[model samples]
Target: MRRHVPGVPLQRWLLVSALVSAALIAGCSARSSAEGATHYLLTDQPTGSEATATGGEGLLRVQRIELARYLDVEGIVMQTSDVAVRSARNHLWAEDLAAQLHRDLAQRLSNQLEGVRVLDPDQQLRAPEREIMQLTVTVDRFQGRFDGYAVVGGKWRLLDSEGEIQAGERFQREQALTQDGYPALVESLKDAWTSVVADIADGLGGAWGR
Candidate 1:
């Protein structure tokens, strides 16, 4: 004869099952929260009306852009202190920052410089027969600061069709954020970038004998 074991009560079994399910759900929720990220694109805001072309005629090619190693990542960077910096884990660029900057600068320059066509060499729009001015930029600082400013610092070189340097200058600008948040930071950065482009346009005008 064998002895019978005691069975667990149905109520106790159901309670244990419920607790296990709840724990699993909680773990999954936590994991999802950790994995979720916000993506941002550095794009131009639409103007109410169409922008008219304003400058002289020429073919300008934006060559491949370079960025600092720290800025090569997708995460948005911030300078926390004089010696410390941090990259946001949740906030990231929606597109490659270097490519986006190249496109943005090209578009802005095209719009501001009348009669001139700005081409991104990466897009393969260059014509060998036509005279083309090449622009190469290397950005070292593109980030937010602890003092509520968005800083952009870089050096740009303009090369003539013969590959001779026409004009080269270091550009730096810091625009104060109107308020706080990533959106504000991005807007300020755009403003600062636009200013830099304006400076380039001025230089280009002088160099091109416009």
Candidate 2:
């Protein structure tokens, strides 16, 4: 039996289809935040380097440590052929590498500096009353050598509230990587960052009469 009924307008039908497609796409795109998350280490209580003089008196106490600026936190600005080789084996991307390094430093510093307030780099920009201390870290070079070795090195600078330079230092550390690829590289980088941070802390403490 043939029957005739009112039909939807062409424009109305098109809109309906578009809306339905969008809904489907949104539903499919939903993802859990922790799906591929990685954990990082923090230096809650850092010990002074052996080279640091232990007998220094009149150490000044820091009221706070602020990470007030990250205008130039570019991830993976430099890479080497060794990085490509390791990436192929470990399936690690440049962004992931940068993120892991950043997380490790943040956590370690937060733990090490107790009683002192730690400010997020992004949040520091909003509050004018608080003193602003900027720390800039640059991964100038990262490579794994063929002599059964891996090395990571970089430069960092600290600036005071008025944008005056406080202290600057460079560090490099290398270690032998096992079968693991990116993880090994990360570990080596962590070691390098630890050394660098300790130096910065010691220098700051000395400058402030601590």
Candidate 3:
């Protein structure tokens, strides 16, 4: 027989093991929290019938349309709160409206035109091309009424490479209150822009000579 040396109790050992496990779990959670995260979502709207052409080459061709920097309009403004003290969503100022329009144009062109390529302003400026089409868009009005109606109005012009006006048109769209607040207003405005672009694209495509 050999003399047994004093040893730590099993209860203490178990407590130590549990504590270590808890520490490890906590550390892992902390590390995970420290890592940055990102989120991506699709925000494209559906295509509409306005872009459809009657009869053409059956196969669509890609084209580039240059956008003007500024437009002649009253500018964009948002209305958030109602006179009735109801909470209104955030209203869209001018910059937001412009940005949304740009995005919508890009998406629509990509969807309607095969192999569509939208050149950046900088890129277009640097590139040398024989002929280019320029689209000048102007927002004449974007506002919400006290009666809960939203409206958008604008004019656009298509110019050829020689700075001759090919075609120009004006459009206006209005809708009653659907959703609650600012987002609803924004959606309405976007819809109006989409309609206008579709009309313009169809009109311009027809004017293109083979």
Candidate 4:
């Protein structure tokens, strides 16, 4: 009979343990990579009117826009019902919600407001020597519904830096989603925002005696 080799058995046990540890490490690495692959989405600026030119209204500043507490998170929110919502688990915003909304709203207003230079506090534009009109939008309900409607609605106030109101009103828009998924939801939000901004433009123009 051959003599038993105790070291051989111990070595074999150590080898098996090492292999198992390596496999577990690889699995964890793969899962981490998959989680990191999550896609982020951003809002777009709505197409502005071609005929509307900046009628030399100087500079319009969009500052201090805000989002609702629930919708201000990184995830995209979906309205499940009249009082319920769901935030996307594997998707998020590429930028800050308030920041993106503020910038995009400014862009849409600038695009259609004609030669009127729309300035955001975060942007590089200079406030003109002309009277600087300030606007702040408080988004109370901005989210996509289960029925494929992207709703953007809230109260906005136009004012000067000194807090004098130029125009104040409540605005809302419901833009339909022709498709599904995040891309479609984003487009819907953009459309809704465009409509709302158009309303703002009209209101501001009227306030300015345009």
Candidate 5:
């Protein structure tokens, strides 16, 4: 047997529905605003934005770049122990890890090489023929360690357009944390990357001078 139910007045039902809708809207707005508040930082200075001139010696194209599989995510990772790792919840990469690394490497090298035209992957696709040399890099370690150090280790190869290898070597470096927190970690990471760039530029020898 069905029991007769009292109906809510039309105006009261409409008011109830509006309240529910408003609550949902506010919740969604808060969530989206929180997500937008996440922080993003580059590992090195952007030479392109520095108003530096280009096209002096030759084009150095980034043929390929690969980041560790675990670090392929948007969140930054830190190895808290040998067997454990932690990722930042509110701190994140604004772009793909490999792509950002490639851009930073290309631009930093460009700044150091003077006349070299750095062709990041995007630019490489546009002017393949202009690239006289290629650089391929693989990042093996790129994370904050338990010891309060930001470590970066990788291998790179510089090759001529003819595929002849010009320079090929491995690089590893770390920046000691001055204090604590993500900002310090990021600064340390930048320092580590800067060290790697210095070595890579040195490997180029007189390539920059030419």
Candidate 6:
């Protein structure tokens, strides 16, 4: 027969059970906190608020936007050194970076260039009679630098409907972050990108015949 052993006292058992439950709850809470991430959108306003059309005006298709491989990831990238970089573990893009760039650039172009409607890669159908021009861009660098500046480096070319290059140039811009952190970095990036759009608009003015 099994020897009769003193069972844990009722009060002691209750206290031990409560302690175990509390420990489990704390563990789960810590795990949840560790796994949660914050997402940020590139645009200041909602995506739906971004207007892609200029009331069927002159067409300018923004296409062939190639971003650096490192920048294509979900998290925002930061250049730790000339040869080293790291992506944020807790901060991430709210949408695809490429798509967000295209849409936001197109919308900015539409606003910058009068009488010209901007079309992004998403626009598949072309207007039959409207003259079309395209802007192809390659972004080599788009990240926060260790020097505490947000940088955007790239090249853009304007091509006519017949696939002839009209005007193009290599460009790079940097904006100083007013404060630290990812939000400030993103804002500086937006300002830098807007400067790029303004340059493109100026180029378009000289390149387009109409």
Per-residue accuracy of model 1 over 47-78 as CA lDDT, tens digit each: 33223323334778888789999999877877
Across residues 26-119, which tens digit of lDDT does each residue of candidate 5 receive? 3357575565545667565664542233444467776657987888877677765457665665566777877777777777777776666666
Report how far off residue 40 is in candidate 5 (Å).
2.3
* All candidates: TM-score: 0.75, 0.50, 0.53, 0.70, 0.69, 0.74
Q: Of 5 and 6, which scores higher on lDDT? A: 6
* Every candidate's lDDT: 0.72, 0.43, 0.47, 0.68, 0.67, 0.71
Report the C-alpha lDDT of model 3 over 1-210, residue by residue, as the tens digit.
112223634443333333233323433565543553212111356564324323332222223333233322222233222331111111114334455566566567545544324343344433433355666667655554434455567676767667687787887877654655345555565666667778766765565641
Distance from true location, Cα of 43 in model 4, Å: 3.2
In candidate 1, position 125 carries an lDDT of: 47
- Model 6 residue 120 lDDT score: 61
Largest TM-score belongs to which candidate? 1
Please report the candidate that would top lDDT against the real structure.
1
Query: After TM-score superposition, what is the CA distance of residue 184 in candidate 3 from its true location, in Å?
Result: 2.1
**Candidate 5: C-alpha lDDT:** 0.67
| Candidate 2 positional error at 142, Å | 2.3
Pairs in clash, predicted candidate 4: 53-114, 53-115, 54-114, 54-115, 54-116
> Which model is ahead, 1 or 3, in terms of TM-score?
1
Q: Write the per-residue lDDT of candidate 2 for residues 144-198, one digit (tens) a residue.
A: 4433234556776667777677776776776554433335544555565677666
Q: Candidate 3: where are CA atoms >4 Å away?
A: 1-95, 114-117, 125-130
Off by over 4 Å in 5: 1-37, 47-57, 122-131, 206-210
The order by descending lDDT is 1, 6, 4, 5, 3, 2
Which stretch of 10 consecutive residues in model 4 shows the poorest summed lDDT? 15-24
Model 2: lDDT equals 0.43
